[model samples]
Target chain A: MLSALPEAISILLSLEGILVLMLGTSLGIVLGAMPGIGSTVAVAIVLPFTLTMSQAPAVMLLLAVYAGSVYGGSIAAILINTPGTPQSAATCLDGYPMAKRGQAGLALGWATVASVCGGLVSAVVLIFAAPQLAAFALEFGPIETFALILLGMTCIVSVSTGSLIKGLMAGMLGIFLSTVGGDPILGEMRFTFGNWQLFAGFNLLAVVIGVFALSEVFIRASAPISNVSELVTFSGIELPRWSMWRGRLRNLGKSVLIGNVIGVLPGTGAATAAFISYAEGRRSSPNRAGFGDGEPDGIVSSEAANNAVTGGALVPTMALGIPGDAITAVMLATLTLHGITPGPNLVQENPTLIAAIFAGFFIINLLLLPLGMALARVAAPVLRIREGFMMSAIVILCALGIYFVRGNPFDLLVMGCAGFIGFLLRRQGFPMAPLVIGMVLGPTLELTLRQGLILTDGNFLAFFTDSPIAFVLAIAALLALMIPIVRNFRTSKKD
Target chain B: MPPTITKLKQESVIVQLLLLITAIALYLSTFKQGFTDAEAAQSPMFFPRIILMLWIVLNIIGLIQSVRHSNVTNPIASWWRILLVIAVTCVYVNLIGSEGFFLPSMVFALICLPLFGIRNGVLIVLFAVAVPGVLVLLFNHMLGMPLPTSRFTHYF
Candidate 1:
């Protein structure tokens, strides 16, 4: 473990690794600041590049991109009504309004500062918590691993805002999509439908880019605006005074804690965390009336919670090799490509790498202060660009990005199909996040169930009875399905 | 008069009927596939079946809710424009394999930009051509994942 630290430091300190990390961070911020482009796209765009790099530096590049993008989205949310990423939606409730009121500089400053603080705090927590959790996870068997994945899937309901039914449907769709490729356990093709391309299932990066980016371009093209003012000049950026900080301490604390907890859960990314934290903050605040009316506290809570998720998300990834979200999932794939398996044995085999990751987190968080400020200053000019030109640029970028995903024309076709489906779903008020989650987790669930069944020699009851953990998870899933129906009925009757 | 709850309820009924029809079709289609012992649990059909079941249930619930409170606020849809874009995209994708990345992408951009109401055709043309060309250079030449160049031409 001790020897691994020096190696980790050497890898991180190398010129190539440093350049990769810095460039990834800068590009991620730009991508993240664009409305409709999220950290998922940023990570996917960089995945191919990491194919040739070493494990430590490659993973570092992706992580830096993820963290930088998470912070970057807030800049657009603050300046414009539109959020650059879904996670920044809460930031816009107050952030845009503040900008409208001529306090754009102040809002940007507070958000940047709060983001840095939250990221650093969560990084510290991740560094301490990941190793301990990994050590504990080392004792788990396949059954336990299966149960943990099930637990992660069950959290889908918590993220089912606006409509629970739609969320479930979307999640089911995602799971179904995951089943398209050859079965991992059985090696039998499932949903290929005679197309050779389906053998590998749907590439998640392509799906995300299409559903989020391309769909966004299509939606924005029809409703173009002109000359969004980007000229923001700050004589001096004002930090939140002691009184302001003191007043919002409870909200900030609650949001950070909620964000960290949500971030540690697989499939539930920073978007869910930000939304949940905003709701919780609004519900509990004394001045709830000010929530969507440029409240500084609202901005602080959402920004802090969302940024805190960057570090919290790393906890499960580094410790257990189970990625907490899509971005980390890609990072895990990169790690695997580089001949590094990031499971329970990772720390024991390479402690220096783990320590270097922890140190990298610290460095990235510190760098956020300057990087975020500079970006905010630069992005201010974009507000003045005509909506028509902006829309054209975004559409072109989306097309190019999808093209680059696999260098296959068929991939673009898949993207177009997904975009069409997403458009229909949006029209019907069905949320898209669940579909993505379902796609991500579908194969894992199917494989686990099959393995468990195979072990039990075709006993139907064995799924529930053979393992206590699986039984518990099943019961929990049952309750989750029922509660929403019950709540909806109760609410309808009351209305 | 605006569409009342009753009219919205009727629409929901139609939606529910369509969903039930689709569900039956999906279930029937599932029978076409043959499953072996190893493929039984994690077959391709397993998840689609699950999704179909969930979709049917959700649609039914949605239908019921719409019927119960039928005050629907339908947003305006520019279907003609949307269909045009989709058609263009399909055509662009079909052309990409034969013509390669550069020309098809540029043409696709030009056709689509007009949908955004950008009347400056010259600017649009420049943007459409320049952006895709630059990207081909960046991703293909710089990034070393050069997009498929056209077999018929030596433009690059």
Candidate 2:
């Protein structure tokens, strides 16, 4: 591992790789700052361009996009009060208020600083800790994998902001939608309704864009047209005074740690990390009363956690080739397209590439401060547009973007249907994130489980007995399910 | 709160009905198809069946929860606007293959701008036409992804 660093650094130092990183990060920031267009769409849209590039630069470009996009989301969340990506929803609580109070620059400043800090910290952990973590993860087998997926599903409770039931409904609907494609284990088909395009599952990007972007347009269309306020000009962007930083230092550190832990968990992703971190920050802060009312700590905790997830998520992806979330899933697909498989053997086979990727991660984090600051200043004006017109344009862009992916009418149809369903679900208070997660993970989970069963020869006890790692994972799943139930009960009793 | 509760109860009942219908449909579909790999411990139907069972349970729980907690803050959007959006989308989807990308998207945008209370006809027309045309040029021409051109191409 120590010897591999030099080779990796050499590969990343290439001019082409640096150019790709800069270009990808810039494009990602722009795309991600647009509500409904997240890293998945950015990655998918850029995939065609990468086809002609060398493998190392191609992967680096996508990685830069993934990292930059996650941080870029806070820009819109802070300025417009609309999260550009779902992961930035936590940032909106205090971010938008800060902007509204004529402190948009300060909010942007803190977000940028926190994002860089989080990204750098996570990258450090990824560099030194991933191989060790991967070694432990190798012990996981089919049962453990199944348990992990189940634990991920349990996160639906936390993500369902308003109604858990509605969230579960949305998730169930997503699972059902996922089942529409060719059978995961067998060559059989289900729910294709005679359409050949249904042989492949619904494109996750189309579904995400439809749900977040197009559905948002429909929802906004009914509201009174409200123009975004004029961009607020600050005399100077101010950081938290040292005294204030000292006050919230412990909370910030805790949130960063929580974010990293959540990021390492498969399927939970940055949004969940940010949500949990913000919630925890609120729970533990001395001035909890200041939450959702322009508190800088809110920005710090949420931004730190969300950005830290960029590094934490890369751990499992690099080690096992399993994506920790939608963006990473796209990155994995992009890597596969480039004929570079990421797995346990990645470091051994291509040390230079891995090192280059890590070095790129470090550079992107360093670049985040200046790039994010400049972009935030520019975005302030654009964020103040009329909500209705902006939403309409967003819907148009989403439709066109989906159409551009494969030039398939079927994909557009899927987007349309998904938008309608998403609108309905949102109106009924259903959380859309769970649905997206389920849709993205469903196929992989189903296929893997079926294959595992095939290997077990129909032995009913094999899942529990085949491996101790699987048993431990089963226990973990049980605990995850029980924790929420217990917490809900305790809260009810306290109320 | 009481009125909100009653409305939520009604919604839950509707959701329950939908869940029941979906369960029956899925169960029937499962019967229509036999398991291809019987030797496998978990077949293709396994996860779907689990999901169906979970949905049924969740819907039941949802109904109970709705009854127990009645205070609800309904969204501001009217049903008419929602239906209008859905109907427009359906029409747009149908029209795209026939009319091509430019016309249908422009028409869709024009139709939608009014739904958002944009009364200025010129601005609506400008937005309706310009956005889609730019997208077509950027994605179809620049990016090399061919979009539907016109009725002549459809006939071919």
Candidate 3:
């Protein structure tokens, strides 16, 4: 691994790699600074454009966007008192206060520095931890893989944030939709309904573009337009004195660690991490009373934690075939589209590809400081682009991109239908992440379960008894499913 | 609390019933296909059937839970605005095949802008034309992805 580091750095330092990373970071910051766009939409919209490029630059571009957007969200939080992305909602609590106190540049600077530090730490964690976890996961057989995916599916319940039943239903619907084409093991066609186009199944790209991008247009079109605050001014890249940093070093470290840990937990996103870390900071910081009143610690905790989540979330995604959040889910879809299967064998089979991605991750963070400063200067104006115009462009792009894939008109219809369905489900409080997860993991779950059944000679009970790993994973999955219910029950009882 | 509960009850009942109907329809759709290789450990219909069963069970639980709490919030924009966007999208999708990429999409942008609260005709017209045109130029010419040609052009 140490020997490979130099090779990875050289790859990232290449002209093309640097250019792609720069473009991705800038684009991510712009989109992330814009309210209602978010990192997931940024990545999904970029996926179509990456089709013309090779896999390494394409993945690198998306990772840069993922990392850049998390940092970008804080800019809006500070300037407009609105988080460009949900992950920075906690930042807004203190960021807006700092900006109001005439320290807008300082708040942004703290956010930028903290984001860099957190992202760097998490990248180091990813570099060290992903391979080790992947090595362990390589021991998993079909049953254990099935169990692992089942555990992944349980993440939908955690992500629901509203109604578990709705999330579960949406997830089930996604799995069912994945069965629209031919059965993998059996040559028999199940749900094609006599259309040759159905034989290939709904294009994952079209579905992703439709569900994430187009559906967002539908939702945003109806959302009330936000007034961008124009009064705020950023003087220059200003950081706190060394004494300030020295005082809050412990807060920054703890928040980054918390962020990384929460990020590694599937379905819990950066927003959750930011809020948790802020609470922890309040609990332990010397400046606890100043948290929501222009305290530097509040901004550090939120920015550090949320940025750290980017690297932490990628851990499971690169190791297991499971995504830690929606952004990674889109990434997982991108990998599948590129014919690069991500699993335990990803590191062994595609060492260079994995190394390039890691290097890109590091470079994107390092570049965030300079790029983020420039972004902070222009974010407010860029974000003020009319919502209607943005929505219109997104819709047009969705139509054109879906058409470009295989030049199929049916794909446009598929995208349209999926967009409508996604809009409806989202409005009803069923999260979209679970749906994407179920679609991505559906075939794997079925294939593994059937293979395990065949291996067990048709004994379902043997699945539990024969493999200790499988049994343990199954129990973990069940616990994940039940934990929410148990927690809800306890809360209700207390009430 | 009472009003919120009542509203929740009404919305939940409607949503739950709609979900239940969909699940039933899904189950019925699979029933026509019948069992495929019933003796086989993993049949083609196996996964779908399991999913449908789970859907049915979850929908029932969801219906019961709805009676306990009102989760429905008012829609962000009016129903008409959402419907307008969907209606425009449906038309745009259908139109793109025959009308080609540029015109249908430009018109979609124009029509959608007002529904999305942008009433400036000049800005709408400029954006409507420019956004789609640039996309076509970038996607078709630059990226070399061939967009559909105008049917009228062929006739000419």
Measured by TM-score, the strongest candidate is 3
Itemize residue pairs with steric clashes in candidate 3: none
Tell me what TM-score chain B of candidate 1 gets against the true chain B. 0.72
TM-score per candidate, in order?
Answer: 0.84, 0.81, 0.96
Q: What share of the true interface contacts does candidate 2 keep?
A: 0.55
Q: What is the lDDT, from 0 to 100, of the residue B121 in candidate 3?
A: 91
lDDT of 3 at A45: 82
Please report, as a residue range, the 10-residue window in candidate 3 chain A with the lowest summed lDDT.
Answer: A222-231
lDDT tens digits by residue: candidate 3, A1-495: 556667767878889788999999998998899888899998988887777678888899899988998899888899888898999999999998999888999999999999999999899889888999999999999988989999888988887778778889988988888888888787677777778988878788888888888889888765666455664766755877787786799999999999999988988999999999999999999899998999999999999999999999999999998888889989999998888888899998888788988878988999999999887777767767777777887788778777765677888888898898787667667778888888898989999989988999988789889999989999999999999989988998999
Give the poorly placed runs of model 2, Cα more than 4 Å off.
A1-20, A27-107, A139-144, A157-160, A163-166, A222-224, A235-255, A265-302, A314-357, B1-5, B34-47, B71-73, B120-122, B152-156
lDDT (tens digit, per residue) of candidate 2 on A1-495: 667777666767767766887777776777677666666666655654565678778888887887888888888888777787888999999988998899887888888778888999888878877777656665566656665555556655555667767777777877777888777656677767677888887876667667766676666655555555444454434565566576787777887888788887766789889999999989998767899998988998899999999989888778766566667766765666566766666776777777778778988888888777666655555555445466567656666566655767777788888777676667667777778757655665676577667767756468778777767767876776676678878988999
> How high is the DockQ of candidate 1?
0.40
Preferred candidate (lDDT higher): 2 or 3: 3
Ranking by DockQ: 3, 2, 1
TM-scores (chain A) of the candidates: 0.82, 0.78, 0.97
Task: Give lDDT: candidate 3, residue A87.
Answer: 98
TM-score of 1: 0.84
